[model samples]
Target: MLTTAEILRKVRALEIKSKKLTTDLFTGEYHSAFKGRGMSFKEVREYSAGDDIRFIDWNVSARFGHPFSKVFEEERELTVMLLVDVSASSLFGTIIASKKDIATEIAAVIAFSAVNNHDKIGVIFYSDKIEKYIPPKKGKQHALFIVRELLSVQSGQKKTQLNTALRFFNNTTRQKSIAFILSDFIDTGYQDALRVAGNKHDIIGIKIYDKMDRTLPKLGLLRVEDAETGEQKWVDSESKLVRYEYEKDFFRITDYSNEVFRKAGCDLLHVRTDEDYVKILQRFFISRNK
Candidate 1:
């Protein structure tokens, strides 16, 4: 557990980082990307020479005996939900920050960006079970509180049951919102839940992984352990076939995950612990804007 002073210091540092990213990089891009989840009718006005014909309010125009167009302004205040995985596997990292750290940083940036755009941000922290939930709210303080929670929350389970988290999110959030699921995705059997949730809300998957996850170093014989399941094994990494099989397994894992996301109709972004995340996020935002 972190002491109160430690929590305070960490939260302050995260707030400063979040502010910088929110202002310098993400403000304009986030606005363009996440705005206009849907537009609401603002008013009706007389149709001009080049107004969109689709928006013509025939009933209103017929009543007034003139063509009118329904004007709509974007409902800019959207609910941004971060479904963060706190499984034990997220603690494993060989380069730079851990998966949990990257997830926290990304969540903080998104939360602060939402605050800047007058949107409410919430978080759902989970392992196999839901650990904590911060209901969506606006304001800088609320955003900071979410960062603190992401940095310090404890998980009641070690295994990852993404289905549980997805079902909980679908049931808890009534209004359609943008949800970012940050995880290593080390589990399976969540396709149905993800499909249901994705059909209702905009779901984006942020897969945080270490480089070692996909490729292994030639370190001769090495001991390995399953971080979440507490299983240990010895592997002869020096053998070419061993290394080839290990690399192939990683490919299979990624292929399966990619297919799951495709079938669910969701977008995915992959971030390695050693890479520059800012560029990944920027590129993601630009693609979505297009």
Candidate 2:
């Protein structure tokens, strides 16, 4: 557990880092990647020569016996939601940073970016169930509050149920929002929930993983415990068959997550703990523009 001073220092450091990233890298990319809610009806006006014919108010035109155009203004406000996983598995890491650490940084970057763009930002922290829900609000203060919570929030449950988070997000957020799910994704049976949410909102999955997660080192026999289930097991990491099975299981889960996101028509990005997530995020934002 982090002391109050330690948490405050970390939060401050994260705020500075996230502010720089948002200002220097993500500001324009984020704006381009996500658009506003949609166009909102403003008023009816006298038709101009270059006005779009589709926007003509037929009823008003009939009453006035002349063509009048319905004017609309782009609704420029957006709500950005971060669906963060606080499962115990996220605390595991063998290189660079733990999944939870990387997630907090990424979430902070996105939160700051949303604030920079004048968008309302919110969070849904979860493990096997919803741990916390911060309703969408605008301003730098709100964004900073989210950063603090991301660094300090804890979950009583250890397992992960992606469907629970997805269902809650879909049910609570009525307006279409841009939601980013940050997790290791060590769970299953979330395809239907993801599909339903995808149909209603813009969903993106950021899978934070460590290199060790994919492959075990060639060490001798080692005992490992299941973080979520509290079960213990002994494994011969030196055995080729054991290592192969470990890697195969990792890929199986990863591949299934990929297929699920793809089938649901959602964007997913995989980032290793030691890799440059800035480049990955920049490329993703650029690709979204294209």
Candidate 3:
């Protein structure tokens, strides 16, 4: 656990970094990447040559004896929800920063971007269950509160269950929202819930990982403990077959995660702890815009 001063310092550092990324790379892309719910009827006006004939107001046209068309405008206000995973697995990182650190930074950047665009921002922090839920709200203060919570949330239970979080989100939020799930994605069996949530909302997954997650170095025999379960085991890292199996499991998980996101019609982005997440996010936003 981090001390209050330490948490504050981390929050301040993340705020500075995320603010720069939000302003430089994600400002415009974030605005264009998400769209409003639907068009709203504005008013009826005399039909013009370029106006679509499908939108012609037949009753008004008949009454006025002239062609009239209904004008519609895109709803500008949007709601963005960040579904963050606070599972113990996020604490493991062999790179410069931990997976949790990367997730927190990215979440802060995204919240700032949404608020900057005049959209409401909300968050759901989960670890095997719904740990916290901050209702969607506008303004910088609200976004800051979320950032603070992200940095300081301590879970009594460390296990991960993505389905529970998705179910909670699906039930609580009725309106369409731009939802971002930030996690290391070590849990499974959430495909059905994910698909259901994706069908209702614009869902995006940011999978945070570390270089060591893909390939473990041969460090002789080491005792490892599961972050969530607290189970301990000893493994020989010198054996080639052991290393190969470890790598194969990592790839298997990665491939399955990608396929699940694709099948649900959602976008999946991979961000390593040592990589530039700002660039990765910018590219994702541009791709989504396209």
Order the numbered candidates by TM-score, best leading.
2, 3, 1
**Which residues of candidate 3, in runs, are more than 4 Å off?**
48-67
Tens-digit per-residue lDDT, 1-290, candidate 3: 78889888887887888788888787688988876566789999999999999999999999999999999998788889999999889888886989988898889998889888889999999999899999999998898889999999977778999899999999999989989999988788989999999998999999999998888789999898889999999989999998899899999998988999999998899999999988888888898688
TM-score for predicted model 2 compared with the true structure: 0.96
Clashes of 2: 0
Instruction: Report each candidate's C-alpha RMSD, comma-separated, in the order given.
Output: 2.2, 1.5, 1.9
TM-scores of the candidates are 0.92, 0.96, 0.93
What lDDT does model 2 reach? Answer: 0.93
Residue 151, candidate 3: Cα error in Å is 0.6
CA-RMSD of model 3: 1.9
lDDT tens digits, residue span 72-177, model 2? 8877788899999999999998888999999999999999999988999999999999999999999999988998899899889989999999999989999989
lDDT of model 2 at residue 180? 97
lDDT order of candidates, best first?
Answer: 2, 1, 3
Q: List the residue pairs that clash in candidate 2.
A: none
Cα error, residue 215 of model 1, in Å, equals: 2.1
Each model's lDDT comes to 0.90, 0.93, 0.90
Estimate, for each residue in 250-270, the C-alpha lDDT of model 1 and write its tens digit: 878777778899999998889
- Alpha-carbon shift of residue 93 in model 3 (angstroms): 1.2
